[model samples]
Target: MSDLRTRPTTKRPPTGDLAAEGRRRRASIAAFYTVLIVVAIIYIYPFVIQAGTSFKTDGDSTYNPLNPFPSLFTLDAYATLADVDFPLWFRNSVIVTAFVTVGRVLLCSAAGYALSRLHFVGRKFLLAAILAVMAVPGVVLLIPKFLILNQLGMYNTFSAMIIPLLWDATGIFIMKQYFDTIPPAVEEAARIDGAGVVRRFWSIMLPMAGPALVTLTVFAFQGSWNEFTHFIVARSSAETNTLTTGVAALTTGQFGSGNRYPLKLAAALIMTIPVALVYFVFQRKLVRGQGGGAVKG
Candidate 1:
């Protein structure tokens, strides 16, 4: 045993000199951080410019397009927003976003659970249909959606804006993928304890879907909040205008010409606040990036 231990068990040290290897390590780290910083600045600089322009006068904004600092910071642009339909648009967005988020939370999870767990007729067909719908581009459905909304007499109303978006194929897909990862034994245990389908799903499964639920909530809120083309065909009245449609109107000279950079940018800047907050709060879940309770197969 002593002779075996004395015999060299460890491999010889790598042939490269320590100093040279250390230099290479330092250089690689420097290169990686350099790339990271550049990418971060590329994303962050546009927002800086937007914020700067939002505080500037029209002339100053035009003259200093790339500058992210105003000559003299002012709230004039925000004040001008008060004079327009910005508040009304903001209110409509809040209402639509709240309703859509809640609806998607319940419906998407339920559908996902059903698709992933329940054994029922037409289940395969239904899942196939959802996948096919996801494969199609969203723009292709605009006219069909418009026609359906108009036919159902939901056009030009809040229902037009909210109902069609309450559940989506993508949300269903995410939830299903998550639910599939959950152990069948868990649900079976609940069943043996006299839990019904609804009981098991509601009391056992739903609570465990935290990551996925957070993910879906963020997507649904952001999608409905920023939805533009659908809202365009869904409603025509100013009363029904959400931030996306209302802000688009501002961009198209509805609020007058000559860039109006401050007003336009301020509106865009304010509208992004809620989405950013949601992202910040749930970013960890976003990173774990799965809604299924755990990753174990």
Candidate 2:
């Protein structure tokens, strides 16, 4: 009885089979990692080459198109950028991105809360309209946007550049989705305590949306910072040029052309830094927001 109790109820898999299965699992994992590494390299190689080319001389970059390591490193490109209005462009981008981000976060959160919680006539219709707007191609609206800005007499001003982007369909959609996931019980308790609608949203609910807020902020900053086409249509002066337009002008030989690859690459590299930093800092929060729980118990 004791021996039977100590023994296996059924025969276990043979040692050879277990070994073979283990080997197969290891091989599968190895293959997965190999593919992942290859894909990462493919995605990252362009940025690596861009950084390398920025440090190379113009002749070196033109000659060594495939090589990431500079044959003759130089800082002439950076110096050239300094002589231009690069600092001014950087300042303009910073100012525009900051204001746009703040406005989008505040306005989108308010709109999202109203759409998700408040009952009003045409609420569903308004959401449907927002969805429809999201589906429309942004390029199709460029002419209309330009016309509106011109009619408003906001053309060639920072207002034209920043105001149109202050509230976006995507931000509202994201916030609404997040708000919907919040349990109604929490808001009900706040209401029972005599909290007003705005008080409940601001002091109770918005505080719980930290991850979603961070995600929205990241997207807003990136979009506004990289905005080029709208800026082009909105403003026509060199003073209003952001990094995107300024760098583009450098690439197109506004200064002078003969393959000034280094200058262009340097400008591109500088412009990418802020977005990259923001992404890295809030990447974990963004992931949490996507997983649908900003306020985890």
Candidate 3:
């Protein structure tokens, strides 16, 4: 009885089932990476071809559309595009994107904060209206937006491009959801210190909302920078053309003197640079925002 505490039992050997389970898990992981690698190659190969083709001659592009290496690399396409409206198009895109991104971020955040935190008479109804607007298809609004812009006499102007898109329903929704997730205790502390609504939002809330704000900035910048349809309906003059419209014109035999594939590809590659940069820079935030917002929704 005294030595019973020191007694030991026989240990069991490893089971076949455990070994089988480990093998199955390893196989599943290997299959997942195999599929992932294939998918990544499929998505990335087109860009590789386009980038390579941009450096090739027109004859080389036609002959070797699938080739990622050119028989003879030429800078003529880029050199030629540099001599045309590329600079103007780039400038216009920068101006429009800057204005629209700034406007959308500020306006959407303001609207969202008010909608989420403020207690107004029609807050519920207004929130519902914003949700409804978000559901409306953007492509269907092409004509209506054009008519309203035309009637307001904003057509063919920068105002035409910027005004209608100054605020978006979807952006407002994202901001509202993010704001709602913020802990009320922090806000309460601010209010207890006798800070007003504006001060609380500016000094307390916004600073704490760095992640959401960065996410919104990325979306606004990308959306406005790549905007195509709104520009088409809002302005018609070459002087007002954005990169999207100008490059589109290039593709449809509207400029460049011939079916200039290399020139157009070069232009596309250039236009893609900003978006690619933004995507890579904020990819982590983008994934986080997506997951957080999905949870809230």
Candidate 4:
């Protein structure tokens, strides 16, 4: 017992060294937090400035571009927006976005389900065509889209705006991938119960796709809401101006001559609210949708 006890207690680490190691660990943690905070501030600073500048006067915004706080706060920008066709633009955007979202969800899901489950003559070729379409840059299609709308006499109408955005290749691809992850047994069991293709898909499969549906809805809403170029080419009437085009006109001196930075910023801020709310509300579902395919029974 004495020999065991006298074995120098495994030469315990020096108290000073332990204290220094703890200090080093704490310093590393503090440094990591400092870097994260700095990066967050860097990324968030512009939005903070934009919000503050929206409340500033024209002179204040012009002179104090970098400063977020306004020396003379005013509601002049929002007041000015009130006089413009802002409400009309907002209404147009809401109508277009609603129809586009619903159409995309239904159509993309149907196409995805067909691609995933149904075997057809040109299924492989059709999927390949869709992939090719996805590869093509959107800007390259602007002229073609415009020409098609003009040919169909859809120009300067809500149909032009809403119909063109109804089907998204990416959304279809996402749904197809998600459906592929589901077990065939689920659908087969429904078929054994005398369910038809439409009934099985609508009742048995669609409900299980909640995460993917939410994700698709969010994308469709945000894409249609913020879409600018398509709306630009699809319609030209002020009566059908979406928030993007209308706000863009504001920035280009559509309302007045001078810089109106505050008005522009306020319009941008207001336009961003719906998208932000959507992301916050459905963020969890979006994450789940992305990872759902990886989960197995």
Candidate 5:
């Protein structure tokens, strides 16, 4: 007869120096967190100051420039913003950003899919040209964009501001890289079932590109929202003024005079809200999106 239960084995005590190892590991962890906290403070301090300054009086902001607290807490800055054409500038910015984001996403995705799947003449050359455009400095295009906008009668118009930004080389590059990672057989199966190129792309391929699309959407939104350089050259009318251009004018005393730190900071603070919300919402997906184009094989 066999014993039903096995004998319990004696557990050995841990060998020497484990306590020392544990203390060292704890110390290392402490040091790592200490550095992280310091860096976070460094990055976050300015934003805190920005928010605080928005509530400050101009005199407080200037005399105690580094002070984050208001000498006299007030809503005058925000009140001033409310009285002015700030809402108009905000609306114009929203309009341009909406158009640019949606247009860039659709156009860039289509261009990327075509470059990835369709075998057409000059495709490689076109991709190379896009790369070359990316290589070209943005400052170099300012004058040309202005001139072309003027010639095309799109100057001082929303079309001028958004059309130029709707399809950038970066978006195309991102989409193409992501699409390259997708297996060809997926599209081929769609084709075998009587799906056409447009149908397959719109129905299957575009939807499969969720990560890239999210990345593109966020990028487009932020870029268009924060765009200053192009807006400067694209339009001169106050009616077409976006937040970036409008804020610049406000800073230069076009709207108001004298330091106006609180007012300026208030505008900046408001401008930051939309981009921050978008980034926070899609941040996790933004991280995952980077992996779409990172295929090893």
Candidate 6:
């Protein structure tokens, strides 16, 4: 009888190249990290400068634009922000962003799920229309959007601010693409169990879509939070000013103040905080979305 543990004479493992392969892999990893660190610094340096400059005086910011540390830290910039209509602008921005993000997430996910799973009439046409709308350049829509808003009698109102952006084409597209990648077995099983459309999506599909939902949440939050273009064209009233519109008004027309760099920088820094928080919280998911073969239009 042959020994059970003995290998066949013709079957030999290759061992010599394993050590060389290990060394090659280690070298590649080191090079990759070196490049990553350099790229990270390039991306992060501007925010560092912006944060430091916000704490400096106007004169200090202009003189030491590249400095990552303030010569003499001061709260004068913040104080000036408090003196204006900043609080109101901040509140309006918060309200609009919250409504828009929630609306987009719910609407886009529903539409995406229906489009991906349901075999209804006009589905192909609806998808084609969405893709076509997504291709339309945003800059060219400025006047058209304003005209429609005026016609709808939503001009200068919160409805005007929120309605146009409630269900974004990009969000719908992202969700549809994500839903398409999911295997249909789960939903089929739910259907076999006599679960309805809502039940299947709510209990099975949406739970499995955790990563995509988190990604969508982050996108919606960032897009609505930092939105400036639509806000500018949608409303002209001082009462309707968001942080972006308000800051722009402050920065451009006040030439008598010798630039007001510190104040401007402070406003920018403050506005950036929400986006930074969202990014830090969901950075891992974002990396996965970009790296794990997720497609974006």
lDDT of 5 by residue, 45-76 (tens): 89989999999988899998788888899999
Q: Evaluate residue 65 in candidate 4 and report its C-alpha lDDT on the 0 to 100 scale.
A: 95
Residue 48, candidate 5: alpha-carbon lDDT:
89
lDDT of 2 by residue, 66-108 (tens): 6999998889989989999899999999999999999999999
Candidate 6 structure quality by residue, lDDT tens digits, 1-297: 976796657844578778888889999999999999999999999989888888998888888889979999999999988988889999999999999989999899999999899999999999999999999988899999999999989999999999888888888888888889889876787789888888887777776676788888898999998899998889999999999999989887663368677788889999999888989988987778542331211
Which of candidates 1 and 6 is the stronger one according to lDDT?
1
lDDT of 2: 0.89
Over 1-297, each residue of candidate 4 has an lDDT whose tens digit, in order, gives 455544545677899999999999999999999999999999999999989999999999999999999999899999988889899999999999999999999999999999999998999999999999999999999999999999999899999999989999999999999899889998888788788889878887787777888989999999999999999899887899999999887777666578788998999889988999999998987776543322122
Better of 1 and 5 by TM-score: 1
- Model 1, TM vs. native: 0.92
**Model 3: lowest-lDDT 10 consecutive positions:** 288-297
Cα misplacement distance, residue 195 of candidate 2 (Å): 1.0
Tell me each candidate's TM-score: 0.92, 0.92, 0.88, 0.89, 0.91, 0.85
Which regions in candidate 1 have their CA more than 4 angstroms from the true location? 1-6, 9-16, 289-297
User: Could you give the C-alpha RMSD of every candidate to the true structure, in order shown?
Assistant: 3.5, 3.4, 4.5, 4.2, 5.3, 5.9
TM-score for model 3?
Answer: 0.88
Write the residue-wise lDDT of candidate 1 on 5-77 in tens digits: 4655887557677778888999999999999999999999999998889999888999999998899889999
After superposition of all CA atoms, the RMSD between model 3 and the true structure is: 4.5
Q: Candidate 2: lDDT of 201?
A: 87
